[model samples]
Target: MRRNMCRNMCRNMCRNMRRNMCRNMCRNMRRNSERGPTARNRQQRNLKIVDYFRQVFGEWAQVEVVELVNDGSGLAFGIVGGRSSGVVVKSVLPGGVADRDGRLRSGDMLLRIGAVSVVGMCARQAACVLRQCGACVRLLVARPAPSNAAPLQSLGASQAPIVPSRLLADPLDLERRLAEAGHDGFGALCEDTTPTSPPPTVIEESLHHRVRELLTAFKKKLWF
Candidate 1:
């Protein structure tokens, strides 16, 4: 009876192992197929839409850059659009890079992907433009303007192109601001000038307290 039970247990374990291996293999195969020619054909079709937009809009389309990192898995967002509606974000997958970034939202109009324009393209075309973007994707999306803001002026020979009201800070500008703000860390929290003379005990304690207060305020600014 003991021998029979042991054999049964071994058989069950072997069956589970085989099932797991098969499941993994199938998943890998599916991924490879997606990464193959079917994927390339899909991409090509999307690029055609991008080209059509470039021909129509030319360089006059207003756009802003939002950078996102793709972790092997595709940028997780669904798009829906056409010539009438233009390419619009339909949904953002939870826990995906787009969701985590918090910049993209459903109904945001896609302007361009990387160097190519998708302004007037459909969803499939817009997605194709995304596939060409290697690892780091630079998306140009336009959110709805504020309700109180003036309506966008029609394009004309006399008018300069309209720029978005809010723009992401340039990397160089951010670095310069950080330098102006001074270094982070407890030691650099506050500057000390009178190193030649020792500060009074009470004064020293007050200075330390002031440093903690300033640090807390700075952190709050960063968090919010």
Candidate 2:
């Protein structure tokens, strides 16, 4: 009887040991996961894409902008992934100052506005800031490669930055200001060749916008 009891005790002890080991292992995993993505890891990540874009373009690179052009295709999507995920641009108003500048495309990331550097801000936040600042805005951005290649780096900036600008912006989306200004919805650029009164030469504005249109369209189509 004692022998049988001893065997049962030994088995219970072994089982208990295993259960404790598993519990400890699980706890460690939970702790590590809770820590989340490290700051160093995030920094080392191919981030700072806009800053790199600014360098690729000249110190005077400008972002092309059309006012009040969401380019959302009738969707109510908030900003994508995280603000740090991609480059952001200044929002445009419908038939406003920036729009008069030229055909500004959505999805372009804004690098520098006039004298300010907008490297690490969310798109909406950046746009709000731009609207607060009056007059013309100069922006530098990165255009995805023409061949539709999966851009150069994994996360950060691009090799060749693109710059576009708009003089006397059309206040793309000043929210309350838009209502105050009595503006309506916006539309895509017409494919016509009606040469409106030209502003100064374009500082590579369309490149980033064209690339972004592709990305935004692709992602949205996949969702709905």
Candidate 3:
């Protein structure tokens, strides 16, 4: 009888330990969920600032010459716009050289690779230039200029072409341009999108699944 009692106590202790662990994990997940979005927004804001600096200042912007060491994964070319308009970075791969340095942004335009000018080169040619740089390479990047302004028509003889107060293109106009270039809506300008909801992270999904499993197990234990 004493042995059976001791065995029951041991099982109870084990059950209690597991319950406590699950509770602790749930609390930690709640804390992370509460804090994650704010941190993410701040990081995104910083990246936007970097892009803004490039856009407003263009080539006149103080050049940031970044030397990236290739680890054989090759440079992540985000988006190369057609007609040599310039390449726009769509996204930087997590943990890559570009991401680690934190200089390259999603909308930054490629200006030059080492001494080679990338101004008029197509996307294929630009990739080739990057490849030739080999193990280590320096990159010059700028923010893409606002492409919204209709080409200023030449005024006859003595008249100056009228300019709009805001040179920044309308969001719809930018979207149309992207569509015309055969982009299936991926690189929409940052200002164009509406904030709907944040996507769930892997950690959040796993935590939710674990919580559901724990609850199911608890229910089964009660039934038994």
Candidate 4:
């Protein structure tokens, strides 16, 4: 009877091991199949968009630079929340007309493109739309109060013709690293700078406060 029980136990363990191995293999295969094509497709699509900007917009379309307003909490880098902060026509190339006019220059955050707010649209998406036939765009620039910051505003629009640029041609390797880690967006990877984390938000603070109060009340109770 003892021998029979031991044999059954060994058989059961072997069956479990085999099942686990098969499960792991299937999972790996599925993961590889899904990720491989997905990565390639994303890479191709992004490159195509860049190409379309050059093709459809032609030479006349201007590229805009954006400056981010940093919160007092310090910044790893600036990202357009794609929500609150709006995009502006930061600069215009010379011979493109805006450069000829003194009113439009760098530091102007385009509050609106004609009637459209640049809230949801990214720079790439904005450029794509300009390619449409006879699109007239109106841009509102942020004119900050004259102070120390006025210099950053003076960088102004570019006069150089939109020609072959490095940004348009080559894809950055860092992009793939970002994808493997499951981050999506326009900006590059940011390094965390803070050594110690700051205090929690209001909800967390309230929960901690309540828990401490409950513990103190329980300890003060005369009856166990």
Candidate 5:
């Protein structure tokens, strides 16, 4: 009787454990359904395909959709791929629909063609997908985000270098000013004559020469 009672107790315990496990699982599922997927979860899924793209491209990566309408010419974009590099846009024909659209660019990695995922697809496979696309083809590609670092670097580079106050004035102009000061042996100033005007610059000299020629011509006209 004790053995039978122990066996019945074991069965009951197993049943209770199973019931609790199912109850907890159901509760968790209900909570998850109520909450739905978070925006972060969606973003994470979106980035999963291009997560490593930044590492390869040396810039922040983003996914973009490019739609091209083929007017019987072609997609106007070439693609090349390898196992290491995966499939990427090789070139874009100038003045073509893709170029005009301006979204598709060379070096962008192919992620999808229309609704079909093209990740890990060989170049031939991607080409086949492109061939099968309808007149209006939608492409999903992973591309590098525009780098702000370049503009920042340019700004830093554009800054004029700091110069010493002493070096700021022209050396010849400084010498002329010093000579005008006429420093005596006792460091006493000599009689101050009116400061001479600076020599004319090339542009000023050219203007003066032109004025003289015009004046000479006018004088000759008056004489005649």
Candidate 6:
């Protein structure tokens, strides 16, 4: 009887331990399954952002810092569009802090301005952030390679950096301005716009003049 009782107690203890182990194993598996998709989605989203930057700025997707000291309201550079479409440098004012620094160029994509990540913010939001930063601001930018092709001459001094209110009110005008400046979008600015048949060089012009004279003589001979 004593032996039977001891045997029964051992069996019950073994069964309880097995049940606890199985329960813990199931809980771990459930947690892993639940967390898997979230981790994967985050990774994929990051990859997409990187790819977008690369597509817009070309292979030069490395991040760079641009520091500027603003005395008052502006950073002296204009940002256009939004985080979804991306905020691009629409213009860098001549003799402004950015221009003086020379690292920030028109068409560079802004990743961050100071502590704020400008990546997903619209132009107005970005401008607002810059305004809040007061006198000094640091920027993270991605610059594309300079094209050998000459940019279209500006109609005048590039339009003054648009105010945030103006950006919000007249987004279409902003698009038009960018188009007029020969920037279709982000990557379009760096694309070769050099005329396929460039204006004749000095030597070519002289040759053309001589050919014209020869042609005129041949015409005279035919007439005779």
Judging by TM-score against the true structure, name the best candidate: 6
lDDT of 2 by residue, 1-224 (tens): 99999988976876676556556655664565556558786565434543554444433332232333233332111222134554443355555444554544445555444334444456665555456545444443433334433322232243232222121112122122323333332112212222222222331233334445655664466445
- Give per-residue CA lDDT, model 1, range 107-185, as digits (tens): 7667656555554457886786688778998665655444443333343321212233222112223222333434221
TM-score of each: 0.39, 0.31, 0.37, 0.27, 0.42, 0.44
RMSD for all candidates, in order, please.
Answer: 24.2, 19.9, 14.5, 19.1, 38.6, 31.3
Indicate the TM-score of model 4: 0.27
Which residue pairs overlap in candidate 5's backbone? Answer: none
lDDT of each: 0.54, 0.40, 0.55, 0.39, 0.56, 0.56
Task: Summing lDDT over every window of 10 consecutive residues in candidate 5, give the lowest-scoring window.
Answer: 160-169
lDDT of 4 at 49: 46
User: TM-score for model 1?
Assistant: 0.39
Clashing residue pairs found in predicted model 4: 88-109, 88-110, 89-110, 94-159, 106-156, 114-138
Model 2 is weakest, by summed lDDT over 10 consecutive residues, at 165-174
Order of the predicted models by TM-score, top scorer first: 6, 5, 1, 3, 2, 4
User: Model 4, range 1-224, lDDT digits (tens) per residue?
Assistant: 99999988976876675556556655665555444547676577556644643453332232232322223322121123222233444445554445444456654434333333333356654444334313333333333333322221212223211222223222232223323434333123223221122134643465456556654554465225
**Weakest 10 consecutive residues of candidate 4 by summed lDDT:** 152-161
Better candidate by lDDT, 1 or 4: 1
Query: Clashing residue pairs, candidate 6?
Result: none
